[model samples]
Target: MAIVVNLDVMMAKRKMSLNELSEKVDITLANLSILKTGKARAVRFSTLEAICKVLECQPGDILEYVAD
Candidate 1:
């Protein structure tokens, strides 16, 4: 995918576990896992906002665009 999800990197930098982030963001672990693994086809703005707020990061930090 040209749009890369860097959620794992940001989580590592923040020293956060998937479970912790899931609880903090009020999202299901399965859903977060899908996003973290770049398998999600789309993400809602509210979901992104919640994740960014919990991770103390911007959306750009978690999502990147690279040419294939």
Candidate 2:
């Protein structure tokens, strides 16, 4: 996949656990886990916004585009 999700990296940098972020973002752990593992097919803008808000980072910090 050209798009990469760097959720774990940011979480480590922020010293936050997945469970903590899940609660803070008001998202289910299972859904957040799917996203963290880069298994998600799509992410809603609202969801992205909520994650960014909780992580104190931009969308670019979570998602990256690499040419194949």
Which candidate tops lDDT? 2
Per-residue error for 50 in candidate 1, Å, reads 0.5
The sequence of per-residue lDDT tens digits that candidate 1 reaches over residues 1-68 is: 89999999999999999999999999999999999999999999999999999989999999999999
Candidate 1: regions farther than 4 A off: none
Give TM-scores for every candidate, taking all chains together and pairing residue i with residue i: 0.98, 0.97
What lDDT would candidate 2 get against the real structure?
A: 0.98
Over 1-68, each residue of candidate 2 has an lDDT whose tens digit, in order, gives 99999999999999999999999999999999999999999999999999999999999999999999
**Which stretches in model 2 have alpha-carbon errors above 4 Å?**
none
